[model samples]
Target: MKRLVALLFALALAGATQAQDGPAAEAEAAARMLEEATRALDDASAARDRVKALTQTVRAYEAGLQAMREGLRRAAVRQQALERDLAAREEEIAQLLGVLQSMSHTPAPVTMLHPTGPVGAARSGMILADVTPGLNARVVKLRAKLDDLVVLRALQDSAANRLEDGLRGAQAARAALSQAIADRTDLPRRFTEDPVKTALLIASTESLDGFASGLSQIAADPTGAPGPAAELAKGSLPLPVQGRLLRGAGEADAAGIKRPGILVAAPPRALVTAPAAATLRYRGPLLDYGDVAILEPRSGLLIVLAGMETTFGETGEVLPAGSPVGLMGGLEPDDDGIVPARLQDPGSDWTQTLYIEVRQDNTPVDPAQWFRTDKDD
Candidate 1:
């Protein structure tokens, strides 16, 4: 009776041990699946293909977790199988022990009951123990690998966001540069035509050149003509010298205030000659000056004669200095409804002087600087 009781107790202990091992083996298998999934995710991220890889990795990790859960479920279900296997093993061990005892007691023949049987069964148990520990270790390693994959995905997302921001900033900078270029081109034309603006610009140029030189330079014509002191001085080059200096180049006061181009103060119907040998660039009506003629001299300087009675020159027509460009006319009323006798120097309230402006490279520079004259009065 004591021996039977011991056998039953051993069988129960074996069943319990098998049941514990079953779940451990399932967990190890599940961990291995998770490890594989994480590895695939890592490869996709390393390729730098897209965030789609991250999504796939996440799915694979979820699948691994699901597989792990399934493994645990299977382990629970296999508990019965573990119990049956253990029962059989325990019965075999007990039978061998019984036979050994019996053989020891037997007098005549020593019959070894199932010799080598117990050795095989013990070996199987040892193998199972070894495999279970190894599987458990693999499960630990797989979990750590999965964690690293998650971190990599996060970093990729951050990098992509920054790249997008930098691209947007570059686009905005290009737009600003284009706008600045356009503004610069329009500025010269807009400011040059305004009478008030023109006066201010001319005055600024003169001030930059100093007073005595400025006045004499505008009063004299560049043409080497023996005449009045003012005519001898190097003023704006007179392409057509027939017209007298109606008004000098500096400040003027006529109707309200006025400044004119070397206002020739010619006869009402007198022919206006080119101040210098020049090509007729443009001949048409201007906003303030009714009839205008713009002549380009060989020296690349432009002579604009405004407030004319008629323009005899046409565009692209070449005329020598002192050639007839147009005829003089009385002042035509402007937007202010005042047909002022001359242009005005807004800075000094001086009037009746000609408004002669010079430009280089389409940019207005100090005209007085180019004019020649003695410094001493």
Candidate 2:
């Protein structure tokens, strides 16, 4: 009995050692697979919630990317290594897509046929008929693979978009560091002797009304260089992030709330850049809306960008056109902030919303009138 007990302990120790030796990347992939399994829905059930499930998948992937990014940052690592990792994954998906594409072009019979003569053809036909069940299985598997290609393509596009955001973020960080160095001695201050006061004033305000009122007390930065006049560049600025415009300015949502803004269906954690050179007015929460940012490109013209998950940059920070402001947060399965904010459409599959409101002379103006609206009609 003692010998048997010792043998059992030895076997358990070996099993533990094997588990310890498992590759971390493989472990991470397994965890992702398990998570997907938990979140999986039946084909019929998924058909009912197709768009919802896809959006959830997108958000889940984005959250995973965000988490990995945070870990890399904490470790003081660059994204090039992570990009390589993603590239390998992308290549595998691409190869699978390639196979599906080839198979789609070729009929099932052609795929089963041999390159030889009638003898080869006879042998192939007999095998095909005998293994009809497997052929049917293959057809079903091919169809599933085709569907996966679509989802994989969508995921790849999102990954590419997020990668671009990451690159832009790195550039912005470097620029911020340079500006910080310059501010110490070179850059002239317009608001206060110490800019920390301005940061506090900007961050402490709870609502937009209070922020606007406080801005009035703090004079404009004269020493700060004037950027391209946003009032003149009304119709030419590029969209802040890559996304399909879901809602147009003045378009009332299902709730019958009409807001003078455009809503974009962007990927989760999509970075928001300045459409034009502007001074950040507010970069904190306001009311029930999520994290928000108000930018003043010129007097009387305020560009408010809201519904961001995480905000960057201080309130008084001046950014050039296309500088990073913040990131779009994932609109989770439980999230309803974007829906009530009218940034989301009742019939849309948006993973996240990039809310844009252009105000002129303190009056909300249609963003369609200002920017080239590429909204889906």
Highest lDDT scorer: 2
Task: Tell how far residue 351 is off in model 1, in angstroms.
Answer: 16
lDDT, model 2: 0.53
Candidate 1 local lDDT, 129-186, one digit each (tens)? 6765554454344333333333323323332333233223222322332233233221
Stretches of candidate 2 off by over 4 Å are: 1-218, 221-231, 331-349, 375-377
What would the per-residue lDDT of candidate 2 be over residues 96-205, giving only the tens digit for each residue? 44554555567656665678977898897687568555534544543443333333333333334443443343334333333432333322222332367557765787
Best prediction by TM-score:
2
Question: What local distance difference test score does each model get?
Answer: 0.40, 0.53
Give candidate 1's root-mean-square deviation (CA, Å): 36.4
Candidate 1: regions farther than 4 A off: 1-241, 255-260, 330-358, 363-377
How close is every model to the real structure, measured as TM-score? Answer: 0.28, 0.44
Error of 1 at 149 (Å): 99
Candidate 1: worst 10 consecutive residues by lDDT? 184-193
